[model samples]
Target: MRAAKSAYPLTWRIMDALEAFAAFVWPARFGRAIPWLMLAPALLLVGLLVLGLWLIGDASLRTLDTSTFLMSETYTLANYRRAFTESLFAVVAWRSLAGSLMVTAATLILAFPYAYVMVRTSSPVIRKLLLIALFLPFFIGQVVRAYGWLIILGNQGMVNEALSLVGIAPIRLLYNYWAVLFGLVQYMLPFAVLMLAPALTAIPEELEAAAGSLGADWLRTFRHVVLPLARPGLVGAGLVVLTLSLTDFAMPAILGGGSQDFIANAIYDQFFRTSDQGLGSTLALLLVATGSLLVGLVFTLFGAGTLAMGRARQ
Candidate 1:
């Protein structure tokens, strides 16, 4: 008790000195201008987001006429009811969720080996070239990329032509579930690589070497050492792919045709084609909520901090 009392005053004195120094430095370096400089971008982003939401909400609140094909201000939940009951919006939402999950799972399986090879390879030049190729597709606009898929998957396109030459009938590839999945996986592959690469690279070589020294084979070392170390990256990559697929509009709009309608496309139709702004907003909000919940669940299950600590003990 006496020793604790003696330390308490010293701690208080040190804290006071730190506080005084902070006050002097804060005014001298930041004063009024620095805070504004730091805050401006954040404030601007918030303002824009709020404004956009407000505009969408306002548009949704207006009533639409089926007779004259006109919209007017008579706020109601009829649009929301119609979205739930009449439009098969619920089915679209389910499809979106399922498609996102499938794409995320497939991308994870595909990307893990590539990411592991990229990080673990001895050839730096080859790794650099491969990374460049992986990310190169991102430089092209999404619309162009989607159209490229269309050309490749179309009846008279490269894929069909090659299949025709093989004497097999041209497959019905375009405007289908497979086409949408292919496009989504291609679009999100770069993200998976980016997320997984850093985590793989950060794993200490000593851990793998130690495992090997203990008579563990390469496969065993990977199973026991590398995978556990990279679980966080796996989870993070899945979340990115899942969220992107969930909110995706372009690929579904272009590749899905009538067969692959997602929630985002449904929302677009409501706002633009049907002019049911309120229902669109509600759908948008639902998408946001669902994405957030899934992301939160992933983090809860495989957070980086927990996984890191688990690996450290091994």
Candidate 2:
């Protein structure tokens, strides 16, 4: 066995030695100890996340004393109570929820055809162009893109400039609920397409051709065959888009221009503007919980996570 190992390439020998060291350090009873060892960095990151969550939870339970402008020594649920009882918080929460849903729906709708065209096109030029368009926005930062929208949609900007030529009045496009949603949809489209592309790629063109030969039209083929096969991607993309839109700060902050506040914006205001760390922590913790819940719900509806898509039987 030692002679056989020596005959192998140096890289393979090194890997074998490393695997043996791992099996020795971590007992074989642990099973696949090298893989577990490889995950140490990720596990440490998760540990740090849990510690931060604990700190946030502890802060969430404390109440601020307005008199001293400090948190109460004793923990209480007053911040949570206020979070639930406040009308403004409710409004912001509802707006975020509704806006995220709309963003997810619109993003998926727009992304599907783009992804489909990119994946199914026989023309290499068409595929490359589609890919370039999809990836171009990714190179631009989200904040920059949001600001670009501001430039385009501003009253005195190019949009209105063009509108003026067409005999249309300068309209108030920025600083509204719709503006925020539009920004979110734009920000999320690339992500949706990237996620959908893999699933769509997994679907063979032969399957689509088979459907067509069986007397199924385009729409019917998409509805019965393509849509069902792409469930994992849709679920994954929707969850990502929804949670990101829900927790977004930049789009609402930049585009909404202080009128439309998402949950993250509200948390920011609490932390910075109001100097209410306790309330801010409460909102932060609640946002985490909400995002986790949404992820869980999506995972439950779908089979598994994006990475776990083809490994269900395993």
What lDDT does the true structure give each of the candidates? 0.84, 0.90
**Candidate 2 lDDT over residue span 1-314, tens digit each:** 35765578799878999999987977679775678789999999999999999998998998878889888889899999999999999999899988999999999999999999999989999999999998999899999999999899999999999999999999999999999999999999999999999989988899999999999999999999999988778877888788889899999999998989999999999989988999999999988888888778777777564646677426
lDDT of 2: 0.90
Indicate the worst ten consecutive residues by lDDT in candidate 1.
304-313
- Top model by TM-score, which number? 2
Residue 132 local lDDT, model 1: 90
Q: Estimate each model's TM-score.
A: 0.81, 0.89
Best by lDDT: 2
What is the Cα root-mean-square deviation between model 1 and the actual structure? 9.3
State, as a TM-score between 0 and 1, how close model 1 is to the true structure.
0.81
Give the 10-residue window scoring lowest on summed lDDT in candidate 2.
305-314
Per-residue lDDT tens digits of candidate 1, residues 1-314? 35766666877989999989989878666676887989999999999998987777676665677786676657776666766686588788888999999999999889999898888889999899888988899899787999999899898889999999989898878898888988999889888988888888889999999999999999999899999878778877888889999999999989988768999898888888977666778778778779989888876776643335446335
List candidate 1 segments past 4 Å from native. Answer: 1-37, 54-62, 66-75, 304-314
